[model samples]
Target chain A: MKNRVRYTFILPALILMTIIVAFPIIYNLYMSLHIWFVASGSGPHWNGLKNYIALLSDKRFWNSIRVTIIFTVGALGSEVLIGVLLALFFNRQFKGKDIIKTIFLFPIAATPVAVALIWGMMYNYDLGIINVLLKAIGLPPLLWLADPKWVIPALIITDAWQWTPLILLIVLSNLESLPTDPFESAKVDGANSLQVILYITLPMVKPAIIVAAMIRSIDAIKTFDLIYVMTQGGPDIASENLNLYIFNMGFSYFRMGMASTLAIVLFTIVMAVNVFLAVIRNRDVT
Target chain B: MSKSYIKTGLFYIGIAAITILPLIVFLWMFLTGLKTQMDNLAIPPKIIFSPTLQNFKSVFAQNNFLKYLFNSFIVAVFAVAISLLFGLPAAYAIARFKMHKIGLTLLIARMIPFISYLIPWFIIFRKLRLVDTYIALITTHLIITLPFIIWIMVNFFENVPISLEEAARIDGCSYFQVFVRILIPVVRNGIFTSSVLGFIFSWNQFLFSLILSGNRTMTVPVAVFKFISYEEINWGGLAAAATTITLPPLILTLFIQKHMIKGLTSGAVKG
Candidate 1:
């Protein structure tokens, strides 16, 4: 009876997780086996891996994968590099550290919707501040989301702006946690700031770096809000990511089976990245 | 001495500018919210516009703004509650037992691209006639909240030693008793952290609520999205609506700024 009751609390969560979380994941696989659309109506009709096969052949699918790679690498690269630098800069005790830390919290709590809106306005070609500033500086105004060439770069910048703080916060905490003995010894040896950081701090924070990289990469891979709001995978799907492609498939095109296939593919890719990280972490743990 | 001061001042300037750019833009939006459409659109950008309550008046008068607000509230609140209920015990299990695989899985669930599930779940919810319902909205919101709860709470629960619960057990408490009587108190910070993250994530969720919620159940994000469409973009109304939708979360963010910052990245970078 006691065991049963203990199970009660755990059971509800397990059941809910199974139903809500696990179910959609499982159902996506089931749906992916079909060649169905909105006309398939209530439940998707099975075509037994045809959708997956189609996804393999689809140019649109390949394009999305390429775009997703660019987005993932671009966003994660800046987030990690800039994040490490920002964390280091803020690590030293300084006046207004508390206030700066608080301000650094903006991108995290600033709703993606609002961030996208503000970015959208900033990226606007004509009346936006960016263009205005460019004009004032005697530089040519670049169309941020209009031209396909610059759209991805613009998104990368905005994404970096929003997420670097997240990585910075994480790495800063990790830096604070580092054993200071080595650093103190290094300082006693008259090592420079750059040498101390490069020699001691960097190596010590590897786990934190890995964790930050993993988390940021995951978030970057799944970016939907800023892209959806700012560009909607536009200027001819220049910014269409896997997530946006999935959104378009499901909502705009109503290709339920194809969308499920895309969703499952995205999930598989994310899992691969995660598994790779986990293996590295496990190796480190040993 | 002069060079050092110049460099220090430049560093401060750079940091401040980097941080303040978005704030200035957000302030512009807030200021636009307080301006008449004509004042808002003026060229040379009347950095000082004649403020008016007219936009707020029309926004509330025109849209079912409160209903949308209530929808956001309902979804955010219940989603937090449900995610906590589902997440806490699992988090507790992961913390005490070190169930690494399960923990990883939960994190992955939280991090998974949400848009992937939008249509698949939409069809299922429609089949069950649960689409656009509060149940659907709140449940769908679990996609955002539960993983956050699990991730945040796991770190908190991990920091708490199991010996306290062992003491409760030796005092003749059941496992549930230990959880209810002991673990909850020690992990209150974790609970608060998870709640804030959950609430914010739910509040910010767009794709699910957009497709899932019908006319009666529209959310602030989608409602803001509605202000711009094919026929004609209502630039003034859109900006006003964006500002209005953004204010509550921004205010809420400031109110809980400390917790919000700690909550967002603390788990991933444990000391």
Candidate 2:
């Protein structure tokens, strides 16, 4: 009787999860296997593995894969490194630490579309404050967005700007949670600041660093708003991420079949990476 | 020593500026929103330009912007409400049962791209004739928010001493009543944090709203995107529009950011 009563509540929750999350994921996988298109309103014609084959042959698909990698790796690597350093600084007892933290949190929670627009304006070559400051310092003004070489860097910079506060939050919280006895023991052992940090601090925070990296990497690969808002993957496909590329294929040109295939590839990559992380994370747990 | 202090000072200041640039730009957008088009785009970008409410008038008066705001409110509200309604029992079960697989599935949901499901959802919603309905948008939004609520509340529920809930169950109170009255009283802040974070995520979500919503259901981001359709975009109007849409989230974060960060980094870093 006791077990049966408990099972009732779990059943409803299970049904809701299946309807909302599980069903859609299954449907997405099924859709990836077909040749569906926009507004056709007609039922999909099954073309087993054709979508996958076409995706393999498509050069633009490969180009987008390359771009997606650069975007994800570039954004994740920089954000975590810079985020830890910032988190450490913020953790230090300093004047205005709270206020600086408040300021730091602003970009992380602010609407992405809006932040993208603000950065878009700031990156304006002529009227933007960045170029003006550079010219005032007697430096030559470079085209921030119009130039191909500078575009992805600009996107990565903006992403790091908004999201480093995220990793910083995680690291700073873990830093605060560290027991004080370790530092005291390290000091007794005649360790300097750098050695203590290298030995005690970094290892202690290794779990957090990995966790932060996984979370950031997950979203980094799917970054759509900032890329779309800032560059629209422009200056000759300089910053076309998988999400934005899939978006363009589906809606912009109405290639839903191809778009679904891209999504499948993206899903596979995310799962593969997530599996790798889970294994490492699981081992850490054990 | 003084030279090293100067170097450290320079480096710290540089990092601070980089971190603060987006906020400064946001302020500039707000200021520009209050200025005329010509002044907004002036070569020097006038800091002292004459302020005007013309853009606000156009935003509110012309764009039917209030409707979009209302839509955001409605979608975010119901979606968050529903996520809580369904997620509570599951989170409680997960916490109580130590159900790692269920928790892991929700975790993977967080990591999956929204586009992976978009293709099918658009099809299903369209076929159901539910496109442009708040119901369609909100329920679909649950994909993003439900997991968030469950994930955050898992910690909150875990934090509660089992004895309190167990004692209630042993008493005359039914399990449901214990959940409603006793357990809820303890986890109010957790509920608030999850609900608010969920609200913010649903409110700011773009791609779902893009395909799911028609003109009547258009969101702030989609509305902002439409301004660029013409060969010519009114720079002042666009900036003003962006500023208008950015304000609510900014103000929400300004107050609730501590919790927002807590929610963002919850399980990622084991603090």
Candidate 3:
């Protein structure tokens, strides 16, 4: 009876997870193996490994992979770099620190779709404040979202703006709880400020930095809403990452088979990245 | 010491400069939302302008902003509530019993890209004729909220000494009673933190609502997307709509900044 009751406690959550996550993942794999079209009256017919084979040769798929790499690296790299700098700065005692920290929390809380629209306005070619500020500073106005060359960078800037603060929060808190003994001893030994930071602080916070990096990387790979609202992978598909590519394939074009195939590929990439990070994290802990 | 104080002051100034620049973009959105159409498109960007509520007026009167806000609220509240209902016990069980498999499963659900679930959800909801209903949106949002609640709550549950529950059990408390009467009271703050985070996530959800919700049940984030479709894009109205969508979560963050940071970083430090 006791065991049955304990099982009941966990059963509801398990059922919901199975229905939502596990079932969909399995169904998606099944859909990827067949020719399924939303518009066609005919039901799906089995095609063994056909969709995957086609994806191997598709230029669009390759372009999306390339774009995903550029975006993931650009966005995650900057967020971590800037986040560490900000965290270091904030670690120092200062007046009104809490207020600034609170303000920094806003972007993470703001809705991404809304933030994207706000960015879309800021990047507007004709009447955008960005170009206006450029002109004021004696520089020529550059198309932000309009130019294909700049679209990916534009998305990266937006992502970095929102998420860099997350890394800041993580590292800042970690910095707070760090033991001060090493710093005190290093200071007693006549270590300079930069040397102390480079040798002492960096090593202490390395694990937190890595954890923050992996988390941000995972979330960054699945970016959709902001990209969807900002460019929709337009300007000749210059910014079409894998997530958006899968979305367009399934929803806009209604190619269920190809979309499912792309989704499975995306899933594998995400899982591999996660597993790679997990292994590193384990090594760090040990 | 005085030289170090000056250096610290400069550092604060620099931090403010870097942090405040991106915030200016948000400030500009709010300011532009109050500008007249011509004033919004003015050359050199209208830094000084008479603010007006006409944009907000139009966003509400011309567009159905309230309906979407209501829909988002309803979906978020119920999603958090249901997630807590199922997730709390599961978290407790995992924490007490070392149910590693269930815990890992929840983490996997959290880790996977949400896109993997979208297509199947679209098909299933459409077939059931449940598309655009609150029931459908709430059910779908559980995917985001459930795993989150379980994971965050697991940390808090582990923090509560098992000895407390053990003492309660010895005092003639049933497992359910020990959970309800003792454990829940102790973890009320965790519940609050997870609920707010879960609600914010659900409120900001765009993809599932984009595909699943129709005109009647569209959410604020998806509704804000409609302001830019193939027509004369209304800059003033779009800013107003965007601000409307942003303000709630922003306010929520301000009030719960401490808990929000704790909840967000709880998993990071341990990981």
Best by DockQ: 3
Q: TM-scores of the models, in the given order?
A: 0.92, 0.93, 0.97
Going through the candidates in order, their DockQ values are: 0.51, 0.59, 0.73
lDDT of 3 at A87: 93
The candidate maximizing lDDT is 3
Error of 3 at B254 (Å): 2.1
Alpha-carbon interface RMSD of model 3?
A: 1.5
TM (chain A) per model: 0.95, 0.93, 0.97
lDDT of 3 by residue, A80-100 (tens): 999998898789777788888
- For candidate 1, what is the DockQ-based docking class? medium
Query: Which residues of candidate 2, in runs, are more than 4 Å off?
Result: A39-42, A282-286, B1-19, B230-233, B267-271
Candidate 1 displacement at residue A216 in angstroms? 1.6
The lDDT ranking, best first, is: 3, 2, 1
- What does the lDDT read for residue A166 in candidate 1? 77
| Candidate 3 lDDT tens digits, B1-271 | 9999898778877977977866897898899889989898787676789999999998898657799999999999999999999999989888877787777777677767787888888888878999999988998899999988888898899999989988998999999999999999999989988999999999999998999898999999888887678323678888888899989999888767887877875554444
Model 1: lDDT of residue B242: 75
Q: Give the clashing residue pairs of candidate 2, or none.
A: none
Q: Best candidate per TM-score, number?
A: 3
